[model samples]
Target chain A: MTSILEVNNLTKTYDQFSLDRLSFSLQKGCITGFIGVNGAGKTTTIKSILGLINPEAGSIRFDGMEMNRQEKQIKNRIGFVLDEGYFYGMLTVKEMKNVIAPAYSSWDEQTFSNWIGRFGLNPNQKIASLSTGMRMKFAVALALSHHADLLIMDEPTSGLDPMMRSELMAILLDFMKEEGKSVFFSTHITSDLDKVADMLILIDGGKILLNEEKDTLLDNHARIKGDSRWINERTRPLFLTLRETPYGFEGLTHQKEALRQEMPDAVFERPTIEDIMLAYVGGAEIAH
Target chain B: MLINLVIKDFMLMKKYLLFLVLFALAAPIVIASQTKDDSLLFLMPFYLIMITEIATYLQVSKFESISRGAAFICATPYTRRTFIEAKYLFVFVTFVGILFAQIVASFLLPSLKTGLNLNAVGAAFLMVSLLFGVLIPCQIKFGFDVVRWIFFGLAFLIPFSLGPILRWYQSLGIHFSFSLPVSQTGQILLMYVFAVVITFVSMYASIKIYEKKDL
Candidate 1:
């Protein structure tokens, strides 16, 4: 697979926090789920790729085009869905569409209409009147209508209801069925990605801890639960994170089979994306 | 893209359109009732120009900041240059539109015609251009808070300090004459060229500042 987006050593510093030399790549025709704790630099990375914030150092290449050099053309082929609605609330849906349609060369009115109709969004309704879910749907519809090859979303499903979230997942799945399309969305909701994302990236403390195919990442990591005695000084390093209770212990590890051979009585559970993320991010808190 | 951006601004200003119409109609009546000299009537629109220009700036600046519309525009396929160009061009269009409306109104109402006195018109144009030259860059670079303070400072401070400053200057034996040389079409043309230069310079500075701004 070829990378549609590649970010290398991207850095941006602020007084309180910094995005440290972040690097990641999104392959063509795959959904890469960007999972991170709050303030883990997901948005910063996304902004750097989009050139919203100029990085202090490093480079971003979209489809082999340098982002800073070919910004306008690269951006035309990429769709962005922001966490919050960035459109003017005073504008009706139709007016907002009119404002945005001219910006993209491949804007499709028929596709836009179909998405709007599917979302049950009234074109005449002022954007401020829509609920958060509806507004997100509208944003997604707008992004997909422009014949964009890559869709980069920042926590678009953060506050959505289950039904809306499921519908959005379905829409993304449908969008990916077409050739040469890819998606990169940052989200705290791992369950949403568990059902949809092909690749999973876990970030913590401004660093990437894991980037692997979702199935592979899940298959490799395991949650081990058993008596606290199973966690000894020699075996401690094997657990990515471990928590002990009065009666037992539970922990996550990547060397599941090796650890299982050592502690034959221990129960090993398949780790979810959430488990993997927590092991990386909640390492300090859960460490024995 | 620039045209669409301007159109978006116009759409956002939809509510203000009715007020503009009312002002257009009521301006003539107010000026007619307040002044006996018809030549001075053109000055009403000049004042209106100042007020409307400031109002438009405040409105759009407030909207952009509040809606976080700059984030949207920045994320889109637009270049910072194009965004700034749309804004500068939008101001030019608004200035022309209001000026044209006033001039047309003057023609329809014979008393309001000032017979194309280049001096007054040229001075008004220069003043508005300078005002925007200072204001737009400040607003674009420093944001609404700084712009608001600068506006209030100028509004209150200038008039309040005028008498004292003049007196202080007089005490220093600094005497100046308030006079104008005989005007010609060439001088009028030169003033316009100067105004255009100032506006464009300000626009270029604004674009540079906005380009580096980490919005």
Candidate 2:
């Protein structure tokens, strides 16, 4: 499959934290979930991709065009919904739309109107007056109205209730129905990714830890539960994270078959995206 | 694209601009009535233009800072140069708009006609250009909030320090005086050229600062 967005050796630095040569790409027509803990350079990476922040080193290409060389052309094809609305609170919805619509050559007034009506957004109301969900919907409306090929969302569902998140997921799923459309969604909420993301890219400490198909990632890793006595030095190295209780020990491991051959009595279960993320991020901390 | 950005700023500042324009029109009439000074009438248009320019800048800066709209603009198809160009164009258009309003008001209220000449207009343009030439880059570098406090600090400090600063200069035992050998028209032309240079330099500086800045 063709790649929609590509980043190679993307590097950015701050005094306290730095994104250390992070690299990832989103395949065309796939929803790629970018997951990382707070302070893990998710926003920094997104900003770099959007040209909001200049990276120290990297090349980001969209549809085979370099971002820096064709920034305006590249941006015209890309739409972004940041964590915060970042809109002028004083302007009414229609007025704000007026401000943005002119910037995009392909802005569709009819589509924007349709979205406003479908979202039940009041065009006359100031953006500040809208609820978080409404603001997000408005943002989505704006992003979609421009006929953009790629949607880049950074924590679009953060602070939203479960219902809004589901709605947002539905929107993304609907958006993907069109061929050659892709989404690069960044969020810590793995459950939302579980519903829609085809590919997953997990990052920690400014580096991508894992980038693979979601199902393959889930199939490769398992939650293993067995007697605490089985967690000796030999077995400890196999588990990504292990937690012990009085009754038993539970752990996550990608080498589930290898462990099964060693300990035939161990119980294996399907691991969720959250479990995988936690296993990678939590390390091997002892839990009593 | 630059026009769109400028229009956006104008839309954001419309309410403030309306209030300022109303006050700009009425305040001169009220002050002219109270002070009964015809000379003050000539200065009134310049003062109003300056006030309108500064108020517009402050409102736009505060809105952008509070709303993170600058960061949002970075995501758009417009380049950083376009954004900076829009700002310069916006301020220039605003200055002209207020000057036009002053001219119309002068026609309506004949008493307000105080022989507003090219020299006065040139002086007003030069003053605003110098002020914004310093203010824009400072706002971009330090942010609106810090620049505001700096403005306030200078406002308070300049008056109090002027006496002491003069005394310090006297203590240095240095005296210098010079007069330019130029015609009135030549000086006016020079002032206009200086204003244009200041504006472009300020714009170049702002663009460089903003391009390197991590939003």
The true-versus-predicted C-alpha distance at residue A182 of model 2, in Å, is 0.7
Q: Give per-residue CA lDDT, model 1, range A1-288, as digits (tens).
A: 999999889888988788888888999999999999889988888877776787899899999999878988998999889898788998899999998888888999999999999999999999999999999999998899999999999999999999999999998999999999999989988889989999998887678888999999999989989998777887788899998889999989999888988899999998888989988888767875
With a 3 Å backbone cut-off (N, CA, C), the pairs that clash in candidate 2 are none
Evaluate residue B23 in candidate 2 and report its C-alpha lDDT on the 0 to 100 scale: 74
Q: For residues B1-215, write the lDDT of model 1, one tens digit per residue.
A: 78888888878888997787567656765676678876667576677777777777678777777786667777778767788888877887777777776777776676766633576667767888899888889888788889988888888998899999989988999667774574577788877888899999999999888877786
Candidate 2 residue lDDT tens string, B132-204:
8999898888888998898778779988999999999999998798778998899989989999999999999
* Quality of candidate 2 docking, DockQ: 0.76
Expressed as tens digits, the lDDT of each residue in A17-60 for candidate 2 is 89999888899999999998998889999999988898999999
lDDT over C-alpha atoms for residue A25 of model 2 = 86
What TM-score does chain B alone reach in each candidate, compared with the true chain B? 0.85, 0.86
Candidate 1, after superposition: displacement of residue B192 in Å? 1.5
**Once superposed on the true structure, which residue ranges of model 2 sit more than 4 Å away at CA?**
A286-288, B34-39, B157-186
